[model samples]
Target: MEAYCSMKAQEVRKLIREQVITGQTSGMATGFTQANLVILKQEHALDFLLFCQRNPKSCPLLDVTEPGSYRPAKLAEGADIRSELPSYRIYRDGVLAEEVNDITDYWEDDMVGFLIGCSFTFEAPLLAGGIPIRHIEENRNVPMYKTNIACTKSGIFEGPTVVSMRPMKAQDAIRAIQITTRFPDVHGAPIHLGDPSLIGIDDVSAPDFGDAVTINEGEIPVFWACGVTPQAVAMQSKPSIMITHSPGCMFISDRKDSELSVL
Candidate 1:
C-alpha cells in the first residue's frame, strides 16, 4: 500500500482494473487527477448534465462517456470505466443496491458515465503548501457529510449538497482555502468553514461517509462542496438504475494535477 502512493495514474488504474487495489484513493497516484463516477441511462444523461451545470461547485464536470462506451476518451486513454475503478456502487430506484469491484454485470448499452472532479486532486497541492491533511496523516479516509444546504434542482435531480470536511486551526484553514482555490475543476475552495451545524451536520465525529479523524483542540471543521453530491442528488430522483464510485473510491485519470490548476 505504501509503494502504491508513488505509482503513476495509469499504473494505479491498471492495478485497480486487475483487482489488486480496492480501497480509497486519497493519497495514491499523487499529482494526478482523481474523479467521482456517476453512470446513468441515456434518458437521464441530459438532465443530469444540466444538474451538474447548475451545481458546478459540487459537480465539476471532468469528462463524460458516450452512450454504451466505457472508455473515458478525454481523461484517460484505453481506460475501461467498468473495470478500472477500485469499487462501484449500484443504486436501484433511489436506494443503494450493492457495491461491486466491477460493473460488467450492470453495464448497459444506453448507459452514460459522468466523471466529476474530486477534492482529492487538491490534497497534493495542500500538502505542498504546508497544509496537513489529517485523514492522510491518520491513515483514514477523509470524512464526508450530507449537508442541509440544498443543491439547485434540474429535472429530477435535487437534494442537499454533500461536503467533505477537514478540521484545521484557523490559520491552516485559511491557507487551505487559498491553496485549493487555484483548482476550480477540483471543487475550488471550501463552501463552509467552522461549525458543522451551519451546514446541518449533527455530529462532526460521525460522518455520513468515510472514516472520522481526530480534530485538534483549536482546529475548526472546514467544509468543501463534494463530488458525492451528484450521487446523493441522483438517488433522490429514484431513477430505474444509477451507478457511482463507492465513497472514497475514485477513478484515476491520466490528466496531471497541473492541468487542473487555474494558475
Candidate 2:
C-alpha cells in the first residue's frame, strides 16, 4: 500500500483502467485534485448546476461537461469518465442498480459528466498542520453522515446536506478552519464542529456512509460539507440516468490541488 501511496495521477488511472485498484482511492494520488464524479443527461444539466450553486457549501461548482461529453476538459485532459474512476454507481430513476468497475456500457449520447471538488485535496494541508485525518491514519474510509440541515433548493435537486467528519483536538480544529478557508472551491471550512448530535448525527461511532473512526478523549468531531452530497441528492431525485463514483473512489485529475486555492 505504501508503494502505491505515492503513485502519479496517470499511474493511478492505469490501475483503475486495468481494474487493479478495487478499494477506495482516498490517499493514492497525493498532490492532485481528486474529484467527485457525477454524470447526468443533458436535460438535468441546468437544474443540477443550479442546485450546485444554491448549495455551494455542499456542492462547490467544479468542471461541468457539455452534452455527451465524457472527457473533462478542465480537470483532467485526455481522461475518460468511464475508465479513469475506480468504481461507478448506476442510478436508474433514482435506484442504484449495481456497482461496476466501469460504466462504458451505459454511456449515452446526451450524457454529461461533472468533476466536482473533493476534500481529499485538502489532506496535504491538514497533515502539514499536524491535524491527523482519522480515516487515513486508520486505513478506513472517512466517516460521512446525513445531516438534518436542508440544502438550498435549486430546480429539481434538493435534499439534506451530508458532511464528512474528522475528529481533531480543539486547537487543531481551529487551525483546520483557517487552513480550509483558503480553499473555497473544495468545500472550504468546517460547517459544524463538536457534538455530533447537534447536526443530527446520533452516534459518532456510526456513520451513514463509510467506516467509523475512533475519537480520542479531548478531541472533538469536526464536520465539513462533503463531496458525497451530490450522490445522495441525485439518488433521491432519481433521474432517468445518473452516475457517480462509488463512495471512496474518486476521479484523479491532472490539475494540482494548489490551483484550487483562492489566495
Candidate 3:
C-alpha cells in the first residue's frame, strides 16, 4: 500500500510528476518541508515581494523563481512547476477562474514562482510533543478560515490574514505553544486560542477550506496564521494574473524537516 512505503520526498515528487496522484498533499511527504506555492507576473514581483516581506507570518518566502523562469533554482531541480503540483488555481485580476491539475497552458515568460512555509511542516513536531491534531486523526485536511485580522499591506497586496484551527486541551495547548515556537519557519506558535469569535470567526463548523473535524468538550480552538492568507489576498488584490497550489495541495521541498529546525 502507498501508506506503507517509507519513501523519500523526491520519490513522492516523481509520483506527482507522473500524475498518478491527484489530491491534497497534506500528511503525504512526511518529514519533508511542504510549502505553499505562489506565482505572479514579473511586473508585480517587486510589489508582491515587498508584500510578502511585510506579512512574514503569512508569507514567509522560501525559494522564488526568476522572472519568466519555471525551474526553481534552489528548491528543486528538474522540477516542473506547471505539472509537479497535484492541482493549481488560476486567478485573473484576482478572481478564481479555474482549478486544474496542470498549468503548462497558463505559463508565460513573465511569470515568477514563490514558495511559502506551511503549517503541515509543524504537524510532525506537534505529534512528537504528544499534542494531537484532530484533522490528521480524522484523515481529513486541516480546517482554514479567513479572519478579521489584517496583515501589513505591501504595494497592491493587502488583506486579512487567514488561519488554520486545531482544538486542544488547555494543558496540551500550553505545551504546544512551547514546542511550536522553535519551528518559526513553518507557522510558529498559536496566534489566538479559546474563543473563535475573538478573531471574528462566527461558526467553527463552517470552514473556508478543508473539512471540519470533531472538537471535544472542554477543548479550546487554537488558530495559526496560514499560508493560504497570501493566496486569498491575491484573490482580492486582483493582480493581472496569479497562480497558487490548491488548498492542501503543496509543493514538497527537498529539505529535511529537521533542516527547518531553528536550533
- Please give, for residues 1-263, the per-residue lDDT of candidate 2 as tens digits: 67667888888998899999977887787788888988988889989888888888778867987789788888877889888898999888889988999889989999888778899888788898788888888988889999999888777787789999999999999999999998998999989998889989998788989999999999999999998998888777778878999988889888888888777
lDDT of 2: 0.87
**Candidate 2, superposed: residue stretches over 4 Å from native:** none
lDDT of each: 0.91, 0.87, 0.86
TM-scores for the candidates: 0.96, 0.96, 0.95
Residue pairs in clash, model 2? 94-238
lDDT of 3 by residue, 1-263 (tens): 25713667788778888887778776676787888999999888998899888887778787899888888767787777888888999889888989999899999999999988999888888898889999989988889989999988878888998999999999989988887787887778879999899888999999987788899999988898899998889878899889999988788887877887786
Candidate 3: list runs displaced more than 4 Å.
1-5
Tens digit of per-residue lDDT, candidate 1, span 1-263: 77888999899998998999998887788888899999999999999999999999999999999888999999997899999999999999999999999999899999999999998889888888888889989988888899999999988899999999998989999999888899999899999998788789999999887889999999988999999888878678899899999988999899999899998
What 10-residue stretch in candidate 3 is worst by lDDT?
Answer: 1-10
